[model samples]
Target: MAASACATGLRGSLVSSFHGTWGTSMMGEDYPALIQSVPRYVRVGPPVRSPPCMKNVNEGKGIFAPAVVVTRNIIGKKRFNQLRGKAIALHSQVITEFCKAIGADGKQRQGLIRLAKKNGERLGFLA
Candidate 1:
């Protein structure tokens, strides 16, 4: 019982001390405006062109603006397959270049691929 009481008091003090460390200035208007004014540090990819059907619906919806904008990728099976094809092509090119750089023959390249697959399984990446 005494040990439990000591634990409760310690936890209460920790919570109170944490609460005390948060300053009221952090909630000030200037602080929020400053934070908002600072641009976000994240990768910005080019927006995909809208489809023909969507283009007709989007006409005259807003005033013409000349600023750059970034958007997330489309979420659909068609888009996924397109991106996957590109990724696979890139992967194949990289592996082919690496094998060529090491002067590996066809048989040696096959052996290397098998070894890589085995290692991936051992590392739980291909499991």
Candidate 2:
């Protein structure tokens, strides 16, 4: 049900009571054998529902190796001699700065955000 139309008052109390009674038995065994028990109904919330924030998320977080992104960058002009330094000239820095510029570091992605904000300024759709 939509948040505004959620069952309230009697319906909520009724549901709470119904579920409360099902979790126990006079013989001390869990009443519902499984979540799909005949009398127990499973209700999935609306598709747009947000789950509780979970931990250990990998994407959108910089909790990954720097090597994968920085190793490909060229440090200097070189056709014969390759002068490379991991700390001083690893390609990861370019990617890191680029990400920082766009605010992927999460403090603020203002550069791209500003560009996007002004996208319509020069367009025929300018407001």
Candidate 3:
């Protein structure tokens, strides 16, 4: 399904350039007169039609639901010291940024709101 969609987009774009050029050149005088003309529909290639299942869905803004996890492995048991200072510091930086945004007001807060909205319902902040 994904492959078909990609091929459709790429093929349409490739042929569209020729289609536009053909239309413009066809309007000019002193074009080759004896050229055997094929039907426009036949010569221009078949139209690209998406699968019926995707007709009502907007491909660009589709929603995704995250799966719930029931079990998680202990981080340090298998790989000792693998996730020590570096992991902690990375998490701390993320927490600090969240705290700053939470504490901010007006202009600063708007940036956070915009990010949340851009993420759509993924963050569960907006329905």
Candidate 4:
């Protein structure tokens, strides 16, 4: 009975403390004024333009982008891009064949792609 009364008293005190002027003093009356003093919109300068050399730079794309970029640097851009396109087509064909062999559907194929992406990220290929 004493324990129950103590619990009730504690609960009541907690409730009262929550409902009381606890946080009001901490915030003070200038809280709203301080909030209103802050400017909503900030002025930004004009967009910066990239240099000519940086402008035409191809950073590559997809999960194999980093490797593609390295290969692109090794081989010339035009030739590398052509080869990359053909290689991508061949890779897609191979993946399609493998999927067919395993009886994997579109969803399974997507899962495989995601798994490959995850593996690539783990292997620092995405970096």
Model 4 bad stretches (over 4 Å)? 1-70, 121-127
Which residue pairs in candidate 2 have backbone atoms (N, alpha carbon, C) closer than 3 angstroms, thus clashing?
A: 70-91, 70-92, 103-109
- Show model 3 residue runs off by greater than 4 Å: 1-102, 121-127
> What RMSD does each model have against the real structure?
20.3, 19.4, 25.2, 12.4
Model 4: number of clashes?
0
Per-candidate TM-score against the hidden true structure: 0.31, 0.17, 0.20, 0.38
Comparison by lDDT, 3 against 4, better one: 4
Better of 1 and 4 by lDDT: 4
lDDT of each: 0.56, 0.42, 0.48, 0.69
Per-residue alpha-carbon lDDT of model 4 for 1-127, expressed as tens digits? Answer: 9999999999988764344385886687888998799897754688777776633222343466677568777888789768856765676677778999989999988777677646655554443
Clashes of each: 0, 3, 0, 0
> For residue 33, what is the lDDT in candidate 4?
92
Cα lDDT over the full model 1: 0.56
lDDT tens per residue, model 3, 44-127? 667888777622222223343221111113334235234434554565566557758678545655565555445544532121
Model 2 lDDT vs. the true structure? 0.42
The residue pairs found clashing in candidate 4 are none
How are the candidates ranked when ordered by TM-score, highest leading? 4, 1, 3, 2
> After TM-score superposition, what is the CA distance of residue 60 in candidate 4 from its true location, in Å?
13
List, residue by residue over 18-116, the lDDT tens digit for candidate 1.
343346557655788887888897537987676765222332223321110111123554665466567556655677789999898888777766775
